[model samples]
Target chain A: MKETITLKIKDLFEDIGNQATFVGSFFRNIFRNGFEWNELIRQCYLIGLKSLNIVLITGFVLGFVLTLQSLPTLQQFGAEGYVPNMVSISIFREIGPVITSLICAGKIASGIGAELGSMKVTEQIDAMDVSGANPIQYLVVTRILACTFMVPLLVLFADAVSLLGGYVGTSTAGGMTAALYFSKSFSSLVFSDFFPAFIKSIFFGFTIGFVGCYKGFKANKGTESVGIAANSAVVAASVWIIILDAVAVQLTSIFVYNQ
Target chain B: MENVIEIENLKKSFNGSEVLKGISLTVKKGENLVVLGKSGQGKSVTIQCVVGMIEPDEGSIKVLNKEINELDEQELKDIRGRIGFLFQHAALYDSMTVRENLAFPLKRVLKVKDEAEIEQRSVEALEAVGLADAIDKMPSDLSGGQRKRMGLARTLIVKPEIILYDEPTTGLDTITSKEISRLILSIREKYKASSIIITHDMSCARITADRIVIMNDGKCIAEGTYEQLENSSDTFINSFFKI
Candidate 1:
């Protein structure tokens, strides 16, 4: 048992070494092959445009629920009119980026993982290498670049939709006027609230694409490895997003508070 | 005959479980060399090392007169243009139509910008492999044999100087195996490419090999013409051929 544990550790180290080497090679190929603009556009369409409805629906629902749930507490304070401001701040700074990223982690991360995992399992990756194609540039770069660009667009869309949902929820449940609620919401949101969340999302996008591509590209063993790679891709990306978000929030609070 | 590929003292290990250990071999240009080995005897690793896919810990691999181990990424990419590999399983991209699969490397690697030229070459390759009608079909729509043929079409589309076959007959019916063997020979004749075929299928080795190399325990145990191997008195060789 002890020997088995030691062997496992050794294996893990070797895998880490291989992954480091591959990442270096992956970046090298990305630069060597330059960029494929059409492929980037296609991936943006797939990752961003195709995923808009889910992000919109989920964000709207989340905003509506948060407003509805906050009504009772704000009513107790006799500051129910402040509900929009609170919901807006929460959504813009924390809920919006975090929730949207979790959704994307599930959607885009799994898609990238499964696509590349299947490619690996099928040996299309090997075929690419043999055909003098840099599979990393052709596969991983398109994906990572797509996620980097698309996630920001998706988050921007989601934030807008969610704020609109907040407006509807406050007017209906809290008996606040739509114009007054939106005015309050906008007044409460400064550049500080918006920029930090937006910046964190780029990290979220990078994390999702990086972990997903890493899992899938390094997949080996057989068909079952594809499933494992996809699952771990989602899990790891989601967890990293949350961890990074916390750190970003802390850093933002420090800088903003002093200013 | 000038050597197209040369390996000297190759060694590789995954987690200390060595796959290829101090192995050496060479293949001449235009020669079809069949590497016969059991399933886990490092045959695939040997070929992968030659292509610089799995880097060996020790020793040297020279392909087309260039040291593969020392080449930079761009250099490797340039070297790769001259070699082709037909995977054991067809390995066709599930999302791509057969035509796209054949054209992918042409456009991506070869930087062939003209759509008409890409299409023409794709069709020619498909025609060569008897897969012209399957061009628009997805890989998932093809039969196993058809998938393998499409894989061959994709490999041939590049017009490589060297072709590597990994278990070309492993999953095919005998009839399909014969067809694949014929395809291999036809590819050789058409391109005059140096070929390295790895398989345990004795019939495949017999039909495709100009010279047969037998690997055991990560080492080249014996090598000769197919008839020479078949007639050898060595116990392992005798048992291998079952004659």
Candidate 2:
């Protein structure tokens, strides 16, 4: 039993080492290939363009629901006018980034994972290598770069849409005009709220893309591995986003309070 | 004949378990060498090692008369441009049209500047593999045999000096396998390119191989002409043939 335990520990260390090596090589390939502009543009369209509608609808619904749910509470306190400020802070600081990332973790991560995972199972990656193509450069880098750029844009769009929904909800509550709501929301949103959320999203993008690409690239065995990789990509990305968000929040609170 | 690829005493291991143990072989510039092996043999590993996909722990692999194991990743990328591969499944990109699939390596690796030239080559490659009409179709729309042929077309678009076929006839019906074999033969004849085919199909080996290398237990067990292997009284060889 002791020997078995020792062997398991050794195996775990070896696996971690192997993973580190693989990730190191992947990053090296990314630098070596530089950036592929055309591929990046193509992927941006896929990740950003195709995802706009879903992000918009989800963001709007989230904002509207937040406003409606908070209405009863704020009205009871005779602070219904604080609705716009509250909604804006909540959407921009937390809801916008978190919800957008979750949606993206579902959409883009799964898309990338499934696409690359299928390619892997079908041996297209091997085909690329044999054809003198750098599969990592061609596939992984394009995707990671795409998500890195597109996710921010998606977050931006989602924030705008959600704010609009917040305006509609406030107007329906019979106390705020669109103009007044915009002014209140904009005034309440300091750089502290926007920048931290925006910065956290970049990390979220990186995690989503990295985990998705990593799962798919390392996928072995057979076709079943593709499905497993896709599923794991979503799960891993979602978890990483939440973890990163927590770290970001702690870091932001320290810095903001100090300032 | 010029030796395009030479492997000497190659060894590989996965998780400390040896897969290719002291395997060695060579392919002349225009010769088609079919590597015959059962499912778990290291046939695929042999080709991957030659291409530097997996590093061998021991021995020398010289491709195009250069020590492949010694080359940097950039150098390996350059070498990869000169070789093509057909995977077991027709590993086509589901997102791209057949035309785009053929054009992918051409544009990315070859850096073909002229769009017209890229298109012309893609069309020609599609024609070569008998996938001319499926240019606009997605890979998902194609039948299995058509998908395989499309894969062959993508391989040919690069005009590689050597083609590595990994289970080229696996999962195909008998008719499709025959067609693929015929396509492989014609491809060899047309381009005069050397090829290393990994397959368990005896008929494919007989039809396409100039020299046959049989692997068992992670080692090369026999190397001979088709007739020589067939006439051998060795139990393993005889039983393999009977099967």
All models, RMSD in angstroms: 2.4, 2.5
- Pick out the ten consecutive residues of candidate 2 chain B with the lowest summed lDDT: B234-243
DockQ scores of the candidates: 0.70, 0.70
Candidate 2 residue lDDT tens string, B1-243: 889999999999988898888998999999999998788788998998888888899999999988999998778889888888787887787778998898888888898879899989999998998888999999989998999899999988888899999999998888889899989999999988899999888888888989998999888989989999988999898766785
Worst 10 residues of 2 chain A by lDDT: A26-35
Per-residue lDDT of candidate 1, residues A12-86 (tens digit)? 999889868866766776766457777778988999999999999999998888888998898999988888889
Tens digits of per-residue lDDT, candidate 1, B124-174, equal 998998888988999989988998899888888889999989999888899
TM-scores, all models, native as reference = 0.93, 0.92
Error of 1 at B203 (Å): 2.2
Query: How does model 2 score on DockQ?
Result: 0.70
The CAPRI class of candidate 1 is medium
* Interface C-alpha RMSD per candidate, 1 decimal: 1.3, 1.7
